[model samples]
Structures are given as structure tokens and as C-alpha cells.
Target: MRARFVSATPSEPAPPPRDGRQSAAALLVARGTRRLLRRLDFASVTELPLLSGRRADIVALSAGAELLIVEVKSSVADYRADHKWRDYRAHCDQLYFAVPASMPLDIMPQDAGLIVADAYGAAILREAPRHKVAPATRRAVVTRFAQAAAHRLHALSDPDAAGAEAF
Candidate 1:
């Protein structure tokens, strides 16, 4: 069966807090992280599906074509319960965990980068170590990113038309 994709757009009303999936706090961290990425000259898409069948919390593309994935951890329990964040490393050049300031910094892995964020903004506390992606993988990732962005934009511009297509 084909999958149906529904992403938020400026014209649509905000989904209920958490949208029955993400917690409000986690969503806030993602919001601030996206802002921070924009400031850093990176364009990002939230909840992007990776080739490995794992969905990333945020996938950002730098001007130099570097890919970074940010996993949002709202609380200690949230971080501990998740084991799939490590799998994200294969899909991007760098991996990071973004949390609110209230989260203790030390609990996060020392290897990946870190960011502390809130609803308004965010700060990168540590830079992630880069593991360059293969050229073929980079091309595939960039293509996916562009396609996702374009699909969302099309949905916003013409909801009926976009919905009619097989996504």
C-alpha cells in the first residue's frame, strides 16, 4: 500500500499539542532547533524519513551540502527509551541531540554533538563529529530532502491537487 504523508504548512492550523506523537516539550525543542539551523545557513525538514526506514526528527542541509540529523530528547526518560538515534548516523554527515536547557548535559552521549533549545531559540553546545557520507548517499539524501520540501510546498499551495497525487 502507498503511504500518505501529512505535514504542517503555514496555511494549516497547528496540530494539537504533540499531535499524539511528539510531546509538547519535544516539539518546542525542534522548533528552536530549526530556527537555529536557519540562522546557521542550513535548511531543515522535520520528521524526514531516512532510507533506512527510520524517521529523523530533523534533517538539515548545509550550504556546502552537508547533512546533519538532530534528535530531540525532551527528558531523561525520552532519551533512555530511544535506542534508534544511533542508526541515524548512517544517514547524515553528523548527528546531534537537541534538548531543553532543563535536561542535564552530561547524560547525552559524548560522541555526538549537542544543542539546548526552547520555544524561542537554541544554542549548539557542541559540534558533532563529521563522518563524510558517500557521494551516492549524499545525492540520494539531497534528492529526498528536495522532494519532501517540494511536496510540502505543493500541499500548501494547492491542497486538493497535492492530495490527489500518489505520495
Candidate 2:
């Protein structure tokens, strides 16, 4: 399923599960990472679809218009099983791996940024190297991100509205 960003509020119902396959630890990391990103003045969405048919665990847009893609790895096996993260580099200005504190830091690739997170918050252990995305690709990704965020907000406001499931 495609990803949609949902805002949480006191009166609103909780958002649906992002992905049933995600481990509890991974969810904690994602939550903390999102909080950290917001603190850094970046707007982020989870499970955003990419042009390459891959779903990014988190996509953040900075105030300066830089895009970042973060892949959450809950375990060593999870990281080893997935090699698609390499493709994400082409879609963002920076690529990072977010993991729980229990995960071994050395197992992650040194080229990408590293983030250690828990349920409360996260810390960026290493900064990701800048990689300029093509103007065309940047335009497309930003468009998709905007559309998804808008759709999710609309859905939350009017759940019964037509095309709510489009995102």
C-alpha cells in the first residue's frame, strides 16, 4: 500500500497501521526519528513511495529545500536481507539509516548517515554526504511528497469523502 502522512490530534482517531511487517523496534526508531526531524525543522512523512517502485521509510524536506531519505533497519538480519536501500541515494540529497540502540552501529554502511533512535527521540551519529539530485528528479519527488501529505490531511478531515483512499 502507498504511504500517506497523518497528523495526530486529541480529537482525531489514531491513524491506521503503517505497515504490519514492521517490527516493534523499527516502529520505535521511526517515531523517534520523525520527532528528531521535526525538531530540526524538517517536515517528514513515513513510507513515501518513490519513482523507482521502492517505499522510503521516511522522507524529510528541510527548510532549505534539501530532501532526505531514511531507511529504518531493526536488526542485522533485516539490513542484510534488504539491499534496495542503495537505490534510494538517487532520490534524495542525503540517505540515512536509522536503527535502534541495540543494533550494532558498525554493521551499517559508512557512506550513509547513521541515526540511533528509541521511542523518545533520536540522535544523528553521522551526517550523510551530500549528493545532488537532478532537477527533474527533485521536482517529481517534491510533487509526490506534497500530494501525499495533502491527501492524508484531507482524509483525516473528511474520512468519508470520495477519493480518500487514493493516496
Q: TM per model? A: 0.86, 0.89
lDDT of 1: 0.87
- RMSD in angstroms, all models? 5.8, 5.3
Best by TM-score: 2
lDDT (C-alpha, whole model) for all candidates: 0.87, 0.90
The whole-model C-alpha lDDT of candidate 2 against the native structure comes to 0.90
Superposed Cα deviation of residue 156, candidate 1 (Å): 0.8
Clashes of 2: 0
TM-score of 1: 0.86
Clashing pairs in 1: none
Mind giving the per-residue lDDT tens digits that candidate 2 earns over 104-164?
A: 9988999999999998899999999999998899989999899889888788767888987
Error of 2 at 167 (Å): 2.8
Which residue pairs clash in candidate 2?
none
